[model samples]
Target chain A: MAELSVRHLLGIKDLTREDIELIFETADHFKEVINRPIKKVPSLRDITVANIFFENSTRTRLSFELAEKRLSADVVNFSAGQSSVKKGETLLDTVNNILSMKVDMVVMRHSSVGAPHFLSRHIKANIVNAGDGTHEHPTQALLDSFSIRERLGQVEGKKVCIFGDILHSRVALSNIFALQKQGAEVMVCGPATLLPKYIGELGVKVETDVRKALQWCDVANVLRIQLERQGGDIAYFPSLREYSQEFGIDKALLDSLDKEIVVMHPGPINRGVELASDVADSEQAIILDQVQNGVAVRMAVLYLLAQKG
Target chain B: MQQQVILGKELLQVTLRRLCQEILENHGDFSNSVLIGLQPRGIYLAKRIQQILKEDLGKDIPLGELDITFHRDDFRRRGTPLRANATNVPFLVEGKKVVLVDDVLFTGRSVRAALDAMTAFGRPEKVELLALIDRCYTRELPIEADYVGKEINSMISQKVNVQWEGVDGGEEDKVWLVLSENG
Candidate 1:
């Protein structure tokens, strides 16, 4: 009886350690199935999943669509760019209208924070938060944790340092909750002004220095500095040049560590900013592995949610 | 808690040897036959038989594992997520005879699911059911094992516990008849 109690996967904040483990356990099976000659399963044949992305994304949307297709679920992709969302329809009316056609599950990415959480309360269908406005990306955190678990043998007691934009990045918050829940120590590394005021209360160790954080952790998940979220003219830091000089992860900075450690990034990589192109493509980098695992992790989340309905 | 000892290691060894020899009579080299262990439990028995074929009889057999957790008819009715195991059937079953190995043949629901799960890879030339313990006349479905070690008259409440030395904590092979709630 490894069923998760939640109707929606809104965030890691709402999921217990057991829910996370069950998702991983189920993901293990999906991982094997995807590698087979016939990379499809009949598990969710009758279930239809809708990918509703109000935000622009390439990797998360495609990975989720593939995951649904692999599970044999009929998928309908939606975006605000081409939908009634551009017209005058509200989020509730739009989702309910989609559900009127009986979309069993929705994997949504929205610009607004807590959009998935808001929709889950209003709709009967299961909602999975792909990414919300700096709130949480549960699946990203899950895959990041899953990747770390695969590399380090276990998530428990392993030190994970999440660097880059801490305040504006949903992945950083979700990883903190997920890694902490699974018995991993969390350290957040970024510019002092860029981190959130709530960081002090999140029970995570804050190290503004990336070099020191790298020395102190097992795996360093270097987050992409959210360029879109940052205003064009607004000065969060002195400049990108100063920010990179102090906080950016280059090969030289990574080499300063006692031993070469695992480096990760949630994709659409800033080749020269948060992580260097050399370090991003290095042997220790698991960026590609994270992309490959995203499909398996999403499949597990969707399958578990479908079982409840 | 009162029960009867169905088969000890000595008796069970003789029965399994006869069963493997019976398989050898029909499936000589087992080149065309593939042995599939049902998920979690049947795997041990499948491994045991495969070991005997390789060690004692010098027949190298192709062994695979099949997990029917998803193909189950009662999947929706069950409370928990069907914690899936690996289904490692690398070879195509298109023309191969599949020996579906399981521990106990009771209701035959698992065998039915295994048949459904096996079709995902390819349709087999033939399929055979092998059970370590067959509770005769207790099947909900009209199913019978072709290679049954022992036929015991077991109540719905009485469970047949088969322990292999490699898997369980027991020293040797053993079978125990224990009572359930309905007993």
Candidate 2:
């Protein structure tokens, strides 16, 4: 019953049910603000947010930038390739340099897991984890929840199937935790070698066959095959064509399921590999909904974290 | 805040019921009457009025909600843009007697903004304004509510906030005014 104030958003596991609901409610308020002719607010006036990204990103970085600017806060983009992070500068020292300029918040995306956790302890300003390697992308999970809740009215009791390479996807990990926390039954489907061992310990159902997993779920969230992050023998499958034929969600597969079952994909979609182009563009697909909800969810996060209380 | 408190919690409720009765008596046909509540508090008040009409006069009036923040002239000053809420009325507004509801009638700026916002949806036959409390000062525009709970004389520096259990639960129906330090 206490007033909600989110200082830092490092992971989905750090948020409670009430905290999630508050984010949704705050997003509902921001929804009205967005529909206005002059789409802006002065809530975070005089506040400066630094986006420190050490990895290649488009959606996550743009979302954080848009969210900060919408709140009328000054935004600064810091790239690892262009900055001292490439010249053997310590992470703490880089953060300290920005803090010296009186930054209010830091939204970071790093290739290493636990990077945000490491920064949270040292930084005085609020820290938002845009993505920290393959560990957890909490905001992505929140935006997914917002999209699902917007379409289905509620996430509780809904069956959600997360398909594709679960080993290297931070999105799959975050969605599994967030969806389960919201009372949705989560099922991850992928090749045996592509899935993590002991995934069930995270309270999710794991399966190797995509067809069987697609039968009972209300939503199918297909994750992109992270080819860039594959450092080991993760690609146990024969080829992209073989993977598509075996586990790809197509129109034929979608026809067998209930009409209400929705399709989703965190994009830069692999076309014919993990999901067919037709399925991604179908009416049942909420890919654009996820993008739009990203703004609302990020607004909720910034509002909750920036509150003085 | 050192402003005149014209209406308390008890008086506000009584006046709301009286306003409902007057609307029903004057516009008794109830054929094409729809109450559109503004976002946040107006939505709650519209529901209350709808319930009153249904209970007292045995008329089931249609209700809807309008979010006028986007149409506001002063949005650039308020920090952070918000998302739009569902304006859930499927019926046509053409030639319907639409009543706009709000919690407090301030500089009449919000109501003026609401009127401008409603035109894009459809043209109404007539539009009426209703408020829980009407402070009769700092009027930048020539606008007055058809139904008002109470009228108070106050300065622009004072802040008046009306909270309800329907919206801000646990501690509802509380009215507070904060005076500006400059005053």
Give the top-scoring candidate (DockQ). Answer: 1
Tens-place lDDT digits, model 2, residues A110-228 = 98999999998887898889889989999899888888899999999999999988988899989988998899999999998788898889889988888789887889999997767
- Compute each candidate's TM-score over C-alphas: 0.92, 0.73
Candidate 2, RMSD to the unseen true structure: 6.9
Predicted complexes: DockQ each: 0.50, 0.12
**Which one is best on TM-score?**
1
lDDT tens per residue, model 1, A1-309? 578879899999999999999999889888877877668877788888999999999999999999999988999999999999888999999999999998999999998998998999899999999999878999999999999998889999999998888888999989999999999999988887778877968889988878889999999999888777676676677767777788888888888778878999998888888888889889999999999999999999998898888
Worst 10 residues of 2 chain A by lDDT: A31-40
- A266 Cα displacement, candidate 2 (Å): 1.0
Off by over 4 Å in 2: A1-5, A231-235, A258-260, B1-183
Q: How does each model score on lDDT?
A: 0.88, 0.80
Error of 1 at A248 (Å): 2.4
